[model samples]
Target: MGDLAFEPPRGGPTLWEIGIPDRSAAEFYIPDPDPNYINKLYVNHPDRFRQYGLWARYTDLYPDGDLVYTVGVSDYKTDWFFAQVTRKKDDDKYEGTTWQIKFNLETVNQTGTYKLRIALATAYVAELQVRVNNQNSNPPLFTTGLIGHDNTITRHGIHGIYRLYSIDVNGALLMEGENTIFLTQPMSSSALQGLMYDYIRLEAPPPNNSTKKI
Candidate 1:
């Protein structure tokens, strides 16, 4: 929802995320959704030079209702967008909010294994529904257990690395060219869970056949 990074590789693949401010307190918080208090959303397109093949959209919900936010490559904006999330009384999983993030690779030059990376601040058994293109009914490529959390170690917030792979749910390799990766966080432990996305890298594998020269 910020500067969606699409810079060309300097040496290897580049990284993208919300750059923290110089000072400590600059860290922002996504509070529990409430009617009286509204949080503004930041949505914008990448710079024109590299905007041809990237896009993103999401929807957040509060106890009261639903709010939608969308930003595309050609249509960029910096207006007031609000978001809210509140914990449920009876249920462990927060309900009603759905996030759909996609990358359109038809025009992208690079090809090969593009690893999808996802980072989260805090969660309890986060279910990541992944799909290629817009095939919603297609079974998720993979689902996460209690990852980045209490399963292996006792941690409260922010896992250093992401949990994702280019392979499908059936353990098959994802095809190169014109593919879109989708991530959906339907339910989570906290209220209004934050999905801090990292960069998706495209790596070209070695050629299948090779000839040795004398």
Candidate 2:
């Protein structure tokens, strides 16, 4: 018989997982359609996300600020906005938004590198910047410099081409207490230039043990 050996999966050990790893954001919060701009065909349908003007509802929901999701407390279905889009101004202009994900860490591993896995369901001419702890870091921890051209948001589609990013986060960036990860889509040329996140996860360093075989 030929030799057969089993190897462990790639990537580091998972420390904390946020949201499902499925290539869609259907599990996240989907706002109800505006009564003034409703589509009869999609009303009460499973694809309620196809309703028009759902993007504009972000302004109505949070008139003053962007979305801030607290890990242990906030409910993704009720709190996490479906899309990270621009905030509308009273002058009829649009501005880029920065979303914050807050979580607490009990301890730190100063010698090991961490992994941040981000999956995007869709993106429309957007640039995503990632910053750990500090929101105004001159050079962000990681940045997807001007990525995606799929106009899935306006089409009312839940997703487009799938894109996954694995970022290596240095241990120095993290602390032993509360940490906040800032996700900024700094493209405001059009309101449609935004991003829809499929899932996000933070992983711990790999163990020192050897691989297993079967």
lDDT of every model, 2 decimals: 0.33, 0.84
The ten-residue window of minimal lDDT in model 1 covers 48-57
Residue pairs with clashing backbones, model 2: none
True-structure RMSD, every candidate: 12.1, 5.1
TM-score of every model? 0.41, 0.90
Can you list the residue pairs that collide in candidate 1? 33-85, 41-81, 141-169
Worst-scoring 10-residue span by lDDT in model 2 = 205-214
Give the per-residue lDDT digits (tens) of candidate 2, residues 128-179. Answer: 9999999999899899999888888898887888888989887778888788
lDDT of candidate 1 over 1-214, digit per residue (tens): 8889775333223222222312111132222333333223412322121211111112232344333222233211221111112235454455534433333322222333333443333333445566655547556665563334322112212223444344312112333233444555565455434333223333323343131211
Model 2 deviation from the true structure expressed as Cα RMSD, one decimal place: 5.1
- The list of candidate 2 runs beyond 4 A from truth reads 1-10, 209-214
Off by over 4 Å in 1: 1-97, 106-111, 148-179, 188-214
Identify the candidate with maximal lDDT.
2
